[model samples]
Target chain A: MKCYYHPDREAVAVCSVCGKPLCAECAQEYKGKVYCKECLAKVKEEEEVAASKSNVSKGDASKSGASEGVVPKSAVSEHTETSSTESKAKKEVPYKGASTAKVVFTSIVVALVIIGLILLSTMGISGVLTPLSLVTSKSSSVESVTAIPYEGERSITVSLDANNCMLNVKELENAIDDKVVKENTEGAKLAVLTSVNTASRMSYKNGTLTVKATGLKKNAVVNLYLTIRIKEVSLESDVKNASFSISLPDIPISAKLSLTNGGISLSNCTVDRINGTIMNGSVTIKNSGVTGIYLKGMNSQISFSDNKFLGNVSLNLLNGTLDVKGNKHIASFYEKGVNSVINCDFSKTEPPMSATFKNITTEVTINVGKQPAVISAPYADVKADSYFTVNGSNYTTPNYSKQYSCLDISVLPAGETAIPLGSITLLGGD
Target chain B: MSDIDARYMLGSILLSLGIVYILSNVTANFSPFWGFIGIFLIFEGSYYTVKYVFRQHKDITNPLVTLFLGIAVLIFTFHIVIPTFTMLVAGFSIAVGAALLLSGFVFKISRKEVLSGLILIGFGFLIATPAVFNISEKFYRYLHIYGVGALLILLGLVLMIPRNKKSVKKDEGGKSDEVH
Candidate 1:
C-alpha cells in the first residue's frame, strides 16, 4: 500500500531508507527512523553484527583467540541448528526484494505526478490558481457574462481572501472552473478577511466590484482579491465585420493591485476611475487588442503587450509607464514626469497618428512603427539616436542609448524652443 | 522550432485586442504598450487588406500606407494634418464599421446567409462611435486622434484577424525531471 501524509488521522509513513511505503503497524522505528518491518529487522541484524565485530582487529581475527570472539548469540545458537534453529534463522532474514521493487515503482509514479502538476501550473496556470479564494454567491443570479472563449463566464463571487491563494480564473476554466450564475444580474457580496476576527464583503454585480462595508477605520487596509476575467475569448468570423466592446468597471483599492490581461478594452474613456482617487491605488493595464483605444489610469504603469491596430488611434499617457509594442498611430498625448517605452514589433502594420511622447521625465524607447515618432519640447529628457528623427527634424534628448541605426542630431528642426535637439544625443552611435 | 498553440493563441490575442481596441476609445484606463499593440494590429489588418484582399499595398486605406500620410503631414504641418487625418479616418472607419454592422442585420433576414453578413452588421454597430461622440472634426482631429483613433484602429484590427484561426498546441517550455 502507498503512504499518504496527514497529521490528524492514521498516516502510512514512508521509509527513510529504501523509501518503502508503510502503514502505522507495518512501519518500524530504528535510530529514530521510520521503515517497513522487513528492512528494520535486517538493519537491526547488521547493527548487532557490526557492534560485536568492532572490538576485534582484522589482523587478530586470523590468530588463535578469534575463534570464539564475536559469535552472535543467535549465530551461536544456530550452529546446532538441526531443525528449529535453522528454521528460525531463515525466518529472521525474510527476503525483501518484492518490497523494495514495489517501493521504487511507487516513488517514480509519485514523483512524475508532482512534476506534471508543477509544469501545468507554471505554463500559464496563474490565471487558474489566482481565483481560488473567490467567494461565489450561494445563489446564482447573473447568467450572461462574456470572457475569453471556451472559458464560460465565471459565476460572481461575493467575497475573496487575499492572504494566500493560487487561483487563476483563466486556468480554472480549462481545468475545473465550475460554478454557475443566474440569468438575472444580482448584486453579490464578495467577502474579504479584514482582521484576525473580522470579515468584510465586497459586492459585485453588473460587472462591477464595490465595497459593501459602511465605514473603514480611517487608514485601515483591506485587499479585495479578484479572479476577474479581464477579457473574454472572441472567435474570429469569416464575416470580418464582427465587432464588440468591453468596458472595465471602476475598481478602487486600498493600496495597489496589478492588472494584466491579454486582449481587452473598456467602454469608459478615462481609466482614472480604476485608480481610486481617495484610495491611493495605481491601476496598470497590459493587453493585446486591435481596436482604437483611449486609456487613462492615474499613477498606473500601462503597457501594450502585443496588439494590432486597424484604423487610427490616440494614446494619452497622463501619469504612468506607457509601453507600446507594435502600433500604428492615429494620435498620441503625453505629459512630463511620466515614462514611455516603445517597442515596434509589427510584422507589417502602420499607424496614421502623429505619435508624440511629450512632457516625459523617464524615457521613451522607439522601435519605430512606419511613421516617425515625435517628441515635442517640454519633454525634458528624451532619449533616442544622435538626432531625434521626426519629420526629418533634428531633435535630441538628455539621455540616449548609444546603439541602433537611423538616429542623429541633424534630424531635429532648427531654432525650436531653447535646447537644440542635436545637443541631446550621441552622434554616430556615440 | 515547431511550437505554439497556433490556434487558440492567435484567437486569444485577436479577441483580447478586440476588447482592448474597443475599450481604449471610450475608457480612460491608460496602458502605453496596449496602445501600440492596438496600433500594431491595425497595421496588420491594413497589411492583410492590401496584400491579400485589395492588392493595394500602398493605398490610403491601408494602415501601413497611411503611415506615409502621417509622416508627410507631420513634416509639413508640424503634426497638424496627421491629427485631422485621424479624425477623418475615424469617420470613414465608422462608415466601414457601419457597413459591416448593416450586413449583419441584412444577413439576418436571410435564413441561409453566411457569417459575412453578421460580421458586416456588427462592424457597423461597433463603429457607431462617431455618432456616439457627436463631435466635429475640429475636436476629433487635434486632441482625440490618439485616444479615439487608437480605439477604432484596435477595433478594426480585432475584426481583421480570423476568429476561427485559434489553434491549440502542447506545452514547449522544456522540462527537466528531478529525483526529489
Candidate 2:
C-alpha cells in the first residue's frame, strides 16, 4: 500500500488513530503508538477540545450545584484528582543544573564587586575627610630673636614654662659686655633667640624674666641666651630638654631648677644652694659647687661629676638612679628612695664626708679609696670586698676610727614594708 | 522542591553575597567569603528546623547536621590569636559533638548523625592540642581555603542534582490515597 502522507515511499506501519499506512519519515511515535503526522496533529487537537469541554461541563455543574446548594460528589472528586495530578507532574520535573561557565562568570563578578567595595571603604573615606592643603603640607619653623636689657640687679630669677620644646640657656660674661651695654642705653642687653613653630612670650618684669611657650608644634626647639652682669642667678624651668651653663662671679649664686619629661644639664656653676626636681628625665651636673643641694626625682637619673657640696645634700628618688663621679666633696649626703640605685666613688672625695642611705630594693655600691671609712648596713644584704673587715652588718676598714677624719657610710631601711633590704657592695682601695 | 525551599535557597545565596560585600568593605585583613556562606547555611538550617518544629516536615536529622556543619565552618574561618582560636574551635566542636551524640544515641536520631558526632568529637580533641600536632598558620590557611571551596562545590552539586519528579509524584499520590 502507498503511504498516506508520502505516497512515493512504501508503507511500514499503520497510523494508530486513522489506520492509515505511513512511511517512517511521515510517521510520529508517541506512547508506543505510531501515527501519520496529519493524524497525530488532528488527534491532539481533538483531545484538547474534549478536555476543554469536560472542564467547561465541570465548572457549569459546580456553579449550578452551588446555586442549588447540592454539589455533585463525583465532580468535586474529579476536580481534586486533576489538580493533584497536575501538581505532581509539576513537582516531578527535575531542576536543570547550572552551567560551569555561568558560575565562573558570577564568581568573577562577585570578586570584582568585593574589591571595589574594599577600595572605596579604605581610600574613599580618607579622601573625603582630609583637606586638600593638608595632604601636601610641609614642616617649617619660625624664628624670633629678642634682647632684653638687664639692669643693675645683684640677683635675677629666670622662669620658663614650655611644652614639647627644647630649651638651651647659657650665661656668658661677654654677652652683655661693655660694647653691648653701651650699645643699649637701657640696661645690660640679654640676647634671647627663640626658634619654634608657634609663638612664645618672654617678659622681663621686676627682677624676674618669665618665658612661657605652650602648644608648640611637635619636636620644636627653642633657644634662649642670657649674658648679664649679675652676682646670683636663680634659674627655674618647667620645660623639656633644658641646658644651662652659668659662671659664678666672686660671690656664688643659687640655682633652682625643675623639669618634667625632659633632661637637665647644669655645668660650670658655683651656687650657694642647688635645688632640682625632675620627673621622667635625667639631671647632669658637672664642674659645679654648691653649699647645699636638694634633688628629688621620679623615674629619672641624677648624675653629679666634679661637684663640691660643703653643706648637707639630700636626694629623694623613686625608680631612679644616682651616680657621683670625679672628686666629689660632699660633706654630708642623705638619700632615701624605693627601687633606686646609688653608686658613689668616694676615692677622690675628701675625708670626713658622710653618706646615709635609706632605701628599699635599692642597690648601693661605694668605693672608698684609701679613706678609712666605717660602713654600716644594719638590714641590708652587704657584699664587701676583702679590703674591708666584715663584722656582722657593719663593714669597717682596719684603720677606721670614730674620732678620726674618715668616710662614714650607712645603709638603713627605707619604708615599713622593707622586709628585705637591697644589695650593698662596699669596696676599699688598698 | 516546593516554592518555599526555592525561595529560601535564593535568599541564602543573596544574603551570603551581601555579607561578603559588606565584610570586604569593612575589613582588609582577610576575606570573609566562607564565613558568610557558613552564616547563610546556619540561617537556612534554622529555618528548616523551625519548619520541622511547626510539623511542616517529618525529618530532623538533616537540618541538625547542617546546623552543626555550618557552626563548624564558621568557627574554622575565624582569624584570631592561635590559643584563643583553637580553644574556641575545640570548645564549640566538643559541645556540638556531645549534643549530637546524645541525640543520636539516646533520642535515636540517625546513624549518619551519630557517626558525624563521633568524628566531630575526635576533631575537637585533635584541635585542642595544636602544639602537639605542630599545625602551622600556613596549613590552617590552606585548609580554610580548600575546605570552604570544597563545601561550596558540594553545595552547588547538591543543588544541581536532578530530582526524579515522577517518583516524587508517585510517592505523594500513594500517600494521599492511603490517607483517603
Residues B1-180, candidate 2: write the lDDT tens digits: 556567667866787778655553333222366557666666565556555554343455666556556655544433221124566678577757865775577555568768878998999887776523433332555677797898899999998997655432246446532221
Off by over 4 Å in 1: A1-93, A96-98, A101-127, A130-246, A252-262, A269-388, A392-430, B1-180
Residues B18-110, candidate 1: write the lDDT tens digits.
644443332222232433343334333333333322221222233332323322222211111112333445434443444333333342243
Model 1 clashing-pair count: 139
List TM-score (chain A only) for every prediction.
0.27, 0.43
**Stretches > 4 Å off in candidate 2:** A1-228, A240-253, A378-430, B1-180
Candidate 2 residue B91 Cα shift, in angstroms, is 42
* Leading candidate by TM-score: 2
The CAPRI-style docking tier of model 2 reads incorrect
TM-score of chain A of 1: 0.27
TM-score of candidate 2's A chain against the true A chain: 0.43
**Mind giving the per-residue lDDT tens digits that candidate 1 earns over A66-116?**
654654556434433423433454477644555333433443343334323
Q: What C-alpha lDDT values do all the predictions have?
A: 0.34, 0.53
